[model samples]
Target: MPVIRPRRLRQTPAFRAIARQTRVHPNELILPAFVREGIGAPVEISSMPGVVQHTLDSLRRAAVDAADAGVGGIMLFGVPAVRDAMGTGATDPDGILNVATAAVVAEVGDALVVQTDLCLDEFTDHGHCGVLDARGHVDNDATLERYADMAIAQAEAGSRLVGMSGMMDGQVAVAREALDAAGHQGIAILAYSAKYASAFYGPFREAVDSQLQGDRRTYQLDPANGREGLREAALDLAEGADVVMVKPAMPYLDVLAGVAASSPVPVWAYQVSGEYAMLEAAARNGWIDRDAAIAEAVLGIRRAGADAVLTYHATELALALRG
Candidate 1:
């Protein structure tokens, strides 16, 4: 019998490049940014090393930088100076998020997609993703009403895409209805369909100065249920989600793959704060190659079926890819 050697394709860089099944492009990366309402300067998040909460001015600069580097989009998260029980700021025309959205859209609207996080967790006093009832539980219906209003606010503020990350039932449908009714039907919805209540969200709490005293297990998916994730994706798709996302990407790649395989719309993955922190910490300690590890981690998400990846490393990686 003739000898068979698959190793022939692994002999050179050109061969490896030609045989590569997956590629990560600069335009397939989205940068997630935090803009604080009252900050005069950018505040570096301790847990998330290089990630920062930006002043409005700094956020504009960052958006310009991301656009210049050819990043696909920027997901804006706002930290308001005040929080009320109803999360009034989330729907306020002059609220931090709305203002920041307008600013970024004006700065980079022509260059990149400007997306906004349409969740109440950063605006509510209790740090929940929705309004709470008298019983201190998240009120799904009331929150849906709030999300409907938020969608309009974000749309009016020039956000091309509104990310519904609250995990509330019927949220996508409600937001879609409201946006259409308000004649902002051009604004797309990005549903955080398979977002899990993972421990990896710790640093994000600090980035937004979260008021969460307990957990969000009531709404967010449980890490143990992979099948449940697919159900959520189906529901979001039926409700008119333009894009479905699997958050905390690395930990739930199996879930991501399942969603990508079935979803007709684009599927995205979020490399959450914890994932970024772990790799950064190891690299700082000399336990790994920083650039190589970051690239591989994002590439793995892409290989697992993410059409695009939301990452804090988007700007740097995009720059490196272009370089």
Candidate 2:
């Protein structure tokens, strides 16, 4: 009888590399970027180091950089200069997000998929993801009407993928119908299917200059409900979502795996702002090896079954992977 050991495969770097079951490739990463309405220069987000609110000029540069780095795509979020009850900016053709989407598409459309965040939060004065009713509760059906308009706006702006991150019920169907009716049937919808209401979103609020006075737990999935995440993914798939996503990837890897295992469409995950901030803060404090930790963190997400990851580290990690 011969004694067997797994150590033989782990004995060398080349062996480990060859035996790796999951690999993080440049094409499997999407960079999430912010472009502000009136900024002349990029403003670094205090809560998220190395992440910034970009001016239109700076956004073009960043898009070029991401394209050069070979990232699969760039997801754009706009910080509007003005806000309104109806979130008029979201549907306006000259709105900040629409403008940024067009600019990024022109800069790197041929090189990578240019995506837009199709949500009203950044444009709404109330900071809710949807329009409010008479009593100030989010109006689901009314918001769907707004989403339809926003979907067309994004498509006209040259966004190849419109990320429906507002988590509105039936949003994917509404956006799909609106896009097809408007002769923009080629556009894809990336549904944020199982986005959890987590504390992990705190830094993102800062990044987008959020104006919320309370919380979004009413719409976003509760953090404790893993089964509910799967149900949401299924709903999105049935509603014509080209892709479905689980956000705050690391904390919800279990949910990610659940969706990945069951969904027919591509399953993507977001490494949100707080996650990036935590890793950066730790690395800056010398508590962890920055590059190694970043690599491992993303690799863990990839291993958990994300077909692509929306991450702040996309460019850097893509470069490292290419090297």
Candidate 3:
């Protein structure tokens, strides 16, 4: 050991900071927001402590805040006053979500990437994503038609990105064709290509007032099957998805890695509501250090090959990192 100088750079904060391979920035964090119809005031989600079902006014304010903070984007999901067989409220120009989309666009303009959840579950009375067949089972083909219409409506309302989250067969292709035919060529699709049938979506049920009677196994991928997720991502990409995503990101890091490894489009991950709530609850009770745990959650996702993360804690995390 003739003066190897192994400690040359270990003595300085600047030196250690310079060694960061993966960084989480405001631009790398996408915030997911929810809005409700006919709500006079903001309603906090019990399960997701810090999250709220914002009124139209509050939703706009949050959107503006996120945009002002330079967050990558704001992903909006609407909770309508009505639900029906066709999820009619979802495509209505005056529907809560569609209205919120326009409001966000008006508020943020191009300062941020305004995105909307292009799914019927939040609007459907029966909690299915599409029209039920004669047997009452979800009809995948019929669902695609509805998704196509949703894509157009969201784009028309000035949403730059439509998240195809219904897990319907051929949804991305159908939406793409519909958008092109309707002359919405610039609208992008963020396909939730590998959304799983997981317990993590439970808290989301309360967030959206979902009336789901049964599981989404008919469409959503099974959690036990990792290879199937790859197939689904492949299908979404071939169908013209501008980006592909894996839901419940932490539980499926391997799937996230696999999708990112081969996806030509950017691969994103959603740290779903349950994941967020659990961490928050634990940190609240002093089971873990809140800031450190939050940082680890995000860092783990980024390390798993996600180009971007859709997180509920996006704004705070960005601020924490900035400090």
Give the 10-residue window scoring lowest on summed lDDT in candidate 1. Answer: 1-10
The TM-score that candidate 3 achieves is 0.96
Candidate 1 pairs with clashing backbones: none
Rank candidates by lDDT, best first: 1, 2, 3
What TM-score does candidate 1 reach? 0.99
Residue 163, model 1, lDDT: 98
Clash totals, every prediction:
0, 0, 0
Query: What TM-score does prediction 2 earn?
Result: 0.99
Highest lDDT scorer:
1
Candidate 2 lDDT, 220-278, residue by residue in tens = 99999999999999999999999999998999999999999998889999999989999
Runs in model 1 deviating more than 4 A are none
In the range 170-256, model 3's lDDT, one tens digit per residue, is 999999999999999999999999999999998899999998898889888899999999999999999999999999899999999
Model 3's lDDT to the true fold? 0.91
